[model samples]
Target chain A: MPHDHHDHDHPHSLLPSDPALRVKALETLLVRKGLVDPAALDAIIDTYETRIGPQNGARVVARAWADASFRARLLGDATAVISEMGYYGRQGEHIVAVENTDSTHNIVVCTLCSCYPWPLLGIPPAWYKSDAYRARVVREPRQVLAEFGLVLPEGQTVRVWDSTAEIRYLVLPQRPAGTDDLTEEALAALVTRDSMIGTGLARAPE
Target chain B: MKEPVFLEPWHAQVFALTVHLSDTGVVSWPDWAATLGAVLAEHGLDRQLDGGEDYFLAWVAALERLLAARGLAGAADLDDLKSAWTEAYLHTPHGQPVRLAGG
Candidate 1:
């Protein structure tokens, strides 16, 4: 079943060693036991691959960039605003939007566990879950951001939000200069997953 | 509360695997709960004390035990894969994706 669908161009050798084999072996063994359904696994993968993830969050950011009223609403009530856009689910039931201003920069981390806005982010990055990040981000937000290649102005203050099971956070990164003419769709293309987490900045206009 | 946020792709894969196994009657929720509880007890994992950092680690350990007990996978297979990943990670240059050589 693992090798049945080989339509994608991804080189099989490029996948991570341990996880890939483990998954494959587990799937094969389970299927043999008649205990697991391949279709269910496929559905889960399809959901993350095609239906959910950073693109949804990008659209929200793009809309905020294009509409002042919507931005205000997003900042004031992220859960309700995101729900209005049909992006509320599971880990994203309660959402909070933190805006990055000229004088202030915001970043998010979950010290307790990897609590995140799943409906928006799909899945968190590996570094986000590493013990190093979980322990250090809250204590040294600026240093962590710098490690991600984001060096803010000396005058700007860094604010770090600790996401929990009760509430999740999304960083609204400041729009870069020279993007006044870009359409909302173009603006969305600039929003990366790291920017929403506050570890990296949005892509600069090229 | 809500399910834990999956950081690595592997985390989600493991989760989906478990859920599918349960849904298909390969493993029941009660069986998983008992296995996970035993694992936590063995590790002396106190949620309040650990701050929930090792939740997924515990889950993986329990899953491995379940598979082994059910004759689905052996310890050797899991260890071999773990070693391969460790080797790949060690050889991989910073910022490059880790992949096993000759894989």
Candidate 2:
């Protein structure tokens, strides 16, 4: 993560290859052509940034942890159950929930491209979309999880779910121990974005 | 692992633009997906994308193609705007947002 002084003065710095500038140009062109509405674009970005995100997934996980029947319904028909919670949308039309148990762990990956449940999780983090992650996680999940500081105990089976354009997987991390007395809202606070992605586990209650 | 506070802001801009286009019935979501998938396959061959600028660059390429195919905007218009922005960027002072003339 060190910044090299020389990198700041790199050659070809003047090239018009900056993605930010290119996007600005494209937006300007599209707006001028009346093909795109800037306000609508802003609203979409704002919605993703604020309204839709992992918090929704956290609530789902919390409900599953607290309600056995809901858990059964979620695992049986995720798309319908999730829609019942009012989280249905594009990129999230079909969702499959994978649960982690004492004997097994589950992780999700899109090896081909970044296809995620947008209504549940916001835009994926950089690591989830990285090529190294997409290629390596499927091949060596335990090692990748280890790099993310999640070292699982031996003997627990690891399940890697490869997402497709049709279906996206969401990991239901095991509820941390000592959380029985906690309220559902309090339990939701323990769920992290990485836990839902299966790279990390939910935080243990303090 | 440390998480950076942000990625390139423009990545989200282009992303929002695509979603807006689809949401407003400018293009169907399935068509956008197919177009983007093709672009990814073409440019993502044999190389590990960082999922940073390169991934979004492919998104832009696909968007341009989609717009052009739909007669929403011609390739020539994109090129001209790109050139204008590049000129604006080069002329603008450091730390200033580049803006096209009369825009």
Candidate 3:
């Protein structure tokens, strides 16, 4: 391999300082090596970015809202219940679903790192993996939630779940009020990734 | 055990690339695993440390080594691509997608 050296001719400031370039370079190298197919890579990216993201998790939340038995099953055994809907794989082998209620709110954080439920939620957002979030969420969750524009009622107690490799947690956001007549699909549309992560609430009907 | 956290967008991209490559029959899982292990061992690093920021850097290095060993590509090819990416990034406006120039 080429030795790692700083190019004195080009200013380091003008060079590719972002990790994106490094990733692109590596991808190009792999494709050129004939070890990776660009089409397959694009497909995978498309799948995670669009096909299998918060939409899957939203469907689960909507099901919980519409079906009491499904909600019970999901809370009691998330891994099995979620897998029943064809959403279980690496990083989501064991999932524990926690419900939000009138008196309680739920949030998740991995103090050491970011361990999100990729099978259901897809890749995590950049802010979720940030050091500021990991350090502050556990200490002052209410403040952090407020920063995300998720101010909760004073009576609601905040509960934080620290995720690890063995177990990952998902927040079952409370069903928004005045949505009793909405269909399951409509309800699913209201569930945002932030709501499932407990950083924000479900979108209020317009 | 340290938690596996992707610190940036590129980290996740690198991860997805590896998985997709393996799934598509480009590289066997065992071969990929062994190559990653050898790369980690070379730097006296462990899997636990691989959760940090430098984890993907190690991944790129391991991948380059594997390509070289397989005779698929060599050091010169990787260097050329790196230079191309550098040029692309420098010329492209900030917040815009960087593409290899003249490609």
- Predicted model with the maximum TM-score: 2
Model 2 C-alpha lDDT per residue in residues A47-149, reported as the tens digit of each score = 8877888989999999999999999999998899999999987688899999999999999998767888888987788777777898899899999999999
User: Which scores higher on lDDT, 1 or 2?
Assistant: 2
* Off by more than 4 A, model 3: A1-21, A28-37, B1-13, B21-103
- The best-first sequence of candidates by TM-score reads 2, 3, 1
lDDT of 2: 0.83
Give lDDT tens digits, candidate 3, residues A1-206.
45346544543334544456656777887776666787776667667656667888999999999999999999999999999999986567899999999999999986645568888888777567655676689999999999998889999999999887568898999999999999999999999988999998888876
**Residue ranges of candidate 2 with Cα displaced over 4 Å:** A1-17, B1-6, B41-46, B87-103
Tell me the tens digit of each residue's lDDT in model 2 across B1-103. 3243236577779898888887778888778877876787777687877877777888888888888899886777777887888777667765566578888
Against the reference, the lDDT scores of all candidates come to 0.75, 0.83, 0.76
Winner on TM-score (2 vs 3): 2
TM-score for candidate 3, residues paired by index? 0.66
Could you give candidate 3's per-residue lDDT for residues B17-87 as a string of tens digits? 87776676666655765676555455433323433554456666776677678776577876778788887
TM-scores of chain A across candidates: 0.81, 0.87, 0.82
Writing each residue's lDDT as its tens digit, candidate 1 over B30-99 gives 5775676566555544332242435555567778889899877788876665666666655666557665
Better of 2 and 3 by DockQ: 2
TM-score for all predictions? 0.63, 0.84, 0.66
Which ranking of candidates, highest DockQ first? 2, 3, 1
